[model samples]
Target chain A: MRCFRFWPALAVISLAACTTAFPQAPNYGNLGRTPSKEEIQAWNQAIGPQGKELPPGSGTAKQGQEIFANKCAACHGPAGEGSQLAPRLVGGRGALNIPTPSRTLANYWPFATTIWDYINRAMPPKQEGSLSASDIYALTAFILYRNDIIPEGQVIDATSLPKVKMPNRDGFIPQRLEDIHDLRARGCGAGHCP
Target chain B: MSSKRSLRRQFLKNGAALAGFAAGAISSPAGKLFAADAPSADLHAYGQRSHFENDVRIGSLAMWPIVPGARRDYGFRSPLQDSMGIITPAPLHFIISHGHEPPDIDPREHRLMIHGMVDRPLIFTLDEIKRLPAVSRLHFLECHGNSAAAGPTGEPRKALAATVQDTHGLTSCSVWTGVPLALLLGQVGVQKGANWIVAEGSETGKHSKSIPLEKALDDCLVVYGQNGEALRPEQGYPLRLLVPGWQGINNVKWLRRIYVVDQPYMAMMESTKYPSARLDGKSRWFESEMGPKSVITRPSGGQQLGARGFYEITGLAWSGGGAVRRVEVSADGGRTWKDAQLQQPIAPKAHTRFGLAWTWNGEEAVLESRCTDDQGHVQPTLAGLNKFWGIDADYYRLPPATADMGNFNAIQPWRVSRDGSVSNALL
Candidate 1:
């Protein structure tokens, strides 16, 4: 008699719970709004190594020489040898295997387009993101020329920058995070080891 | 303790932080209880630490103030030797900047743009973000370049002056309150094949990094609150991406953009700066996880252990993979080991305090701690880590083996002399 009295309430509760098993997709506050075109243009400036977003304009190392001397030399040094104020952009080839490795663009960086991208986003320290498309292309060209990877007369823009490969383009290998898991599961040399 | 530390401690004893506010109270004629004004008048308005307490963080030491060609490459170091527990005080928290001052952003105007590879590209204001469901969790943020075992240009084994702060101060844990990135991504609907997201900051340089979308959706946060208060300006103030377990740089400060993409952008920070070069002549890119690491703080470098008959050996252990499951303390280098008791609230991806009972006999000894994470990954010794990289055993002198590369998590050993003076064993 006591169990029968509560069965009606229990049956109603169980049927209500069944309806919420899968759950309708949450329609939060609908808080985010569509971004305007100007907003997208202002922030979406990250240029990948593929040079998909390189702006129009071309420059040569000859043209880069004058621009680099005036805008970049005070801190980067006149010949791009780097200074107390900045890291070196030239020299230091074949040094990665040594004990005291001096890593620089010539020996370490894997992409030529990276030079242009970095210059566009963060160069000249306090005056970052202030360089023009042509000026950034020229600076990238000048750095490549200084590293002896490019001729002074070579033009660098969206088209040519992607083709001018870095000296150590293949130096970096993609790290597989699962390797740590695999190494722990197996012995020291299970997957790949010393 | 060194004479310099003793002098600093003596100065801090006389109400250093509360100097100007309660000058008359401290300088009273006798041990009287009366003072210049009410205690509430001095502080209590908002909040402040007691005027008497004055443990401070080290701003710059022997090897730091590293100015890398006009970038703001320095930060304050937390005093781990004097640290009491897991949560670093918001004010005393370590602060680092790669470029430009933390922007003086108005929270009302600041916006986070979520574009690329998203079915519904969207922009959310700070107010809008706060209205979404909020969650809080504890995690530790550590710099990849936080070790202090760099040897001299030629002589690598020369002993030097260092403290717990000098060696392992770049890490701090906190209760961060924010929105899970997964919740926001769910709202926007991540498109298929979208595997990476480039996080960009709003500093003058717009410092940025590309994080794996899987990690982003799993545990990442867009945090605005730290340790029960609004985030400090130096700690990305209005907003920051809290990429737990990964190195500090991946937790981009002043976060303003999240650009979803199919391929890694190979940004300079990733391709040029943070990648680790191995012995096989190839560098490792996207090396995200910090290895399990531990360090003894109380009896560590720059501190004197006077008349040590019985002293508790306590330290911190953490991992990027998961919770620290076990920590072993060795008093005679790595020869012998003993398990330390884990403290309560052993939150994953955060600092876990471990204590072991030790009775020191007035003798020379080297102390070290090795941590094992839940994933069965044990911390490596300096020799072992270098051996894995195919480098020489005397690893300190080789910049390529130590400082030049990042992700340094070797066991730190402190040598306690017969006189109870402690210093760095590896240096």
Candidate 2:
């Protein structure tokens, strides 16, 4: 008899727990409207080392020279000699390995992909990643030729691009990580030698 | 209208930050962390600025400054020399961070855990770790990439005095007080086969690293105090692992967990990014330890002097592998060198301040410094250093093996003009 009496109460408690008090929704004062498709598309683009975000269309080194002369010559100087505004991209091969390494691309940079990636990310300073896929290829080819890495007449395309190797491809050294195990085995502390 | 409102908000925020700095000055046990002799008003104004200061608070163990605002740009560096005795004061020590602001951690809630290849898993609260027997010693920590630009054949030889604090200034030595990692590893019972130990931080980026397990069982320390005082928020408050003779990056900050493993943690900061220079014309996977170098500080760059007379050329010298036994300063370029006076109680792996007095002939002259650590290793020049490492491996600056190359100890030359103007001119 006592169990039967508590059962109904338990059922009523469970039912009560299930119900939630719903208040009238508060009004949210609207601020800015949703962005348009064009706005969204403009911000979504990014170019990876493998020409991931490259746009359609093709261009040749001949066209790229016109673009380079009109746009890049001011800062980079003719033939990428580099003015005060920009860094010299040519020369510097085997320079980083010399005592007191200068750390330029020719001397220290390990990957050719870095050139493509950097150009896609931060070239022109003002207009970033605006070049079409063909333009990028042409620019890369032109720069490589100017750096004396590639033949001036060599044609650069998707299939032939990845094959190019940088002089500093093997430039990096492994991190020492300073195991400090030997130091400890020898009994070293802050001040007193172990 | 929006600009006006924002200006008002800025005022309120500044007011609040000022109050916080003032409260810290008064309530903290160390008292005014900088310029205590001056009135509170002047000190408050000085605190509001964004420049690094030279004055250090008296009685603080480590020579650190109470940085007023959060990280605005790159963090500040502590002065290595001009300090006597060991134990860098907490306020005056060096500061380095990548982001806009340094993380602030609450010690009461903080805990460090050891996991992975350990026989037994363990977690120790900050309080529990503090209860263990502590050891304090003065030591220096240098960023691996320190002096990356100031190598052989350049103007701004005095870049050492000015730039040292910027690049190498990431280093500091203080009487760190903490429970040894060996004790902690002993408690957890490190697994037999485990060779590498990876330490992870709780900061914004979750920066992590893999150190040799032997190091964890050796002299690595989980420190809570610097220079006999509680660690500052900027200097990895609550707990920071001190790995002597290693690059600053390997010494994990805001330490949270230690995982024992068979292989090293090839985190981005280590394998791909930091490592530069390959042997088969390929990358050297790992290179560590900052080599010997010296920089003059008192007559550093970007300072307006009252009048040029007899000024002492003084600066700090240090190494990672061992103690700095000797330091030489050259005022007439590297053609000749004079021994600079080394401060006493020079502990191994700590900054040794050296000074030399010179009377300027009121003409232009070059200034540079060199150091020899406890180990037989000597600083090298850029030209010599490049021959061994290769031009590609220019990212990190390791300790020099000889005075011949590697650019570790390229003779720094600071040119002083007749008008008392000091500039880095490669003469």
Tens-place lDDT digits, model 1, residues B1-427:
1234434433443333223222211121111222333346546567765544445654432111233322133446676776677788877777666535678989889899999889888999999889988999999898776673442211211244466666787888899999999888887888998888889988777878888888898899999999988898888879999988988889988889999887778788877877766655677666677878888886777566656577888889988888999999999998999999999789889999999988889799999999999988888888877677776656555542322546677898999888666778864
TM per model? Answer: 0.84, 0.57
Query: What is the model-wide C-alpha lDDT for candidate 1?
Result: 0.74
lDDT of 2 by residue, A17-129 (tens): 43332212221222112334454344323222243334554444566687788767777777777655555667755444333334455554444444654565456654655
Best model number under lDDT: 1
TM-score of 2: 0.57
Q: Give the Cα lDDT of each candidate.
A: 0.74, 0.56
Give candidate 1 misplaced runs (Cα > 4 Å). Answer: A1-25, A175-194, B1-42, B60-74, B148-159, B398-403
Interface Cα RMSD for candidate 2? 15.5
> How well does candidate 2 score on lDDT at residue B177?
81
- TM-score of B-chain for each predicted structure, in order: 0.85, 0.74
| Model 2 C-alpha lDDT per residue in residues B252-349, reported as the tens digit of each score | 88887777766654553554345533334444433445667667654544222234467777777777767889988887767799999998778777
